[model samples]
Target: MFERYLAALEYPSQGGINIDDPKEFRNIVLWLEDQKIRHYTIEDRANLRKTGSATDWDPAYAKYKIDLGFPANLKSKTEELTWLFLYAIKLEYSDNADRYRSITAAQKIEQEKKSSAAPEIKSTNPFDKLDFTSPDFEEGSRKLAEKLGIAYHPDHLVSLRAASYVISTALNKEVLKEPIITGKPFPIDEGIGMGFENHQDLEKAARILRLLQIQNLRKLQTAINETIVAVQNITADPRTDTSLGKVGMK
Candidate 1:
């Protein structure tokens, strides 16, 4: 019966259409237009729209949800699916749809249990270790964050001084601590109070940063030397007229 209804409506038999896929979902709009199913209330819209294009569903979806004693928002996908199952019944998709409803309910209950059992741990700082030298470097990070479903802030330092606290805390915990003598120390130790799980990891990261800095310095020095050498070569050329600057002699 469900299959028959979907066939009659020309709705896709396969399910799980993501709301974000605009190209694949334009078909739903066409189908609704063909049926002349316009001006649907939010409730009805939720029913027909199912997974995409809020405007495509009938407003009755809202009412269907209300009838089932669930909230209108249906925040979670499972919650929305439960409402969709009820909406399917309202559409006469199946005469004996209790089995489907039961399955959906079980799935919803399982989802709720899992969410309750293990709540996700939130990150304290989202943009940690995010550093950049150029604007392009930061832009690349922002693009990557979007693809990875992470929040990006145009916030991170490029200088080694900005990361000094991290390196100091990890490598020189003793220097950051109070003097063992217990007397007033001449220099107050500056520490961010963060500890490393493995000092070796911290050392490795610091080493890599140092190596990169050294490599960059070497490249800059080489470029500077090459420029100086080129200038010397030009000044020493015998074919050059000193005042006229490299005039070809007849």
Candidate 2:
């Protein structure tokens, strides 16, 4: 996928730049490519050619390319290449989804059983407290719905699902111990088969992150309470600490 993205950018396959190196840089590649595809449309092809957002595209790609001794020129082919990249990404996602679905029902059941035996630390999603009606969230939800080709009525369940995807992805990146963004993109088709795999993976990650956070807090609170109780008991003791005094005096 990274190589395909590089090819779309007209980057050389043989060069000093290792396209698969230094995990952080690889993550940036994934994030950029995902953002581009999520925003792609048939209507924007003309606009892309006529006027492009170099401000949007240049700095990140150029930084990596320069080190590899490639020219930083990406403006002219931006539209053509973007379309190709989106096509490739969507195709690969479909292939992966098909492969994933081929697993037997028994295997899935066993896997679920194993997962269920694990301890669960339940917590309310921080997103539950958020004001979804805020302008920033509303605008984000709209863009997300448009990206996923979901109908965008504010009151609709589909819109809420889209909002959850956006929120979960953000939380998984920012809050999780192993951030999901540094990992792979969602694994299924975004539009037609969204809820089956792609959206499910993201939501599961988000739930794990929220639970981990709540569990950690509970542990910390327990430790603190224990420490306070110990201190109070020591303070209330009528006897002086003979062992400590003996050691200090000696």
Candidate 3:
């Protein structure tokens, strides 16, 4: 998908994509996402340019002589391309939902099994105390999320929120196992248990981070639910009545 985006830029449209109109030049090729998230079909995704984003970009796509399924009602190249972007992300969200469901279901099972044991009071989400009253946090978080291309519209916040918590909680689990020393210690079985420093600061840090993690994890679940609902609200296929791009780009 991104290769097509780069290819679109190669043809010079919309002043070409404004990478610096945003931030950091990270390679968008992310095969490193969670193993559960994957291509929805066997289709060559890089060649997934189903519609042109600009009349100029049409030539670039035409140079390759590829054809895309014209989106429903969008006639302009830009509109079709924009719709394509939404569709692509929708596909991504769909895949992520699957992964999220599986992970959560497994977690639920684990929790059920553990429920028979003594109850463990878990940390509250630190994110709950965030200063949402001030516009700074929401504004900054939204912009940063957009810059990082995580959550763009409010609808996408669900997946973004969930993913963030999953990361924090997973990290906190490791941090809670503290007395962490950089260097390898002698085997405990050999009576050489030494050099592990238990800092009060780490204990506090772990608590804060854990709280934040738990908070976000629940938010993430909410986000996922909202996203599923949002998807349900799309009643029309935008490309349904659309015509294809006009052939001449001169």
Better of 1 and 3 by TM-score: 1
- Residue-level lDDT of model 3, residues 166-209, one tens digit each, is 55754477866876567875332343223333675665556556
Stretches of model 3 off by over 4 angstroms after superposition = 1-67, 100-250
What TM-score fits each model? Answer: 0.22, 0.19, 0.19
Summarize candidate 1's per-residue lDDT along 174-218 as a digit string, tens digits: 765866556665321233322443685775556556666978999
Query: For each candidate, what is the lDDT?
Result: 0.53, 0.55, 0.48
All-Cα superposition RMSD per candidate: 20.8, 28.3, 31.9
Clashing pairs for model 3 are: 71-239, 72-239, 72-240, 72-242, 125-211, 125-215, 126-211, 126-212, 158-223, 162-220
Better of 2 and 3 by lDDT: 2
The TM-score, computed over Cα atoms with residue i paired to residue i, of candidate 2 is 0.19
Q: Which is superior by TM-score, 1 or 2? A: 1
Mark the regions of model 2 whose C-alpha exceeds 4 Å error after superposition. Answer: 1-198, 242-250
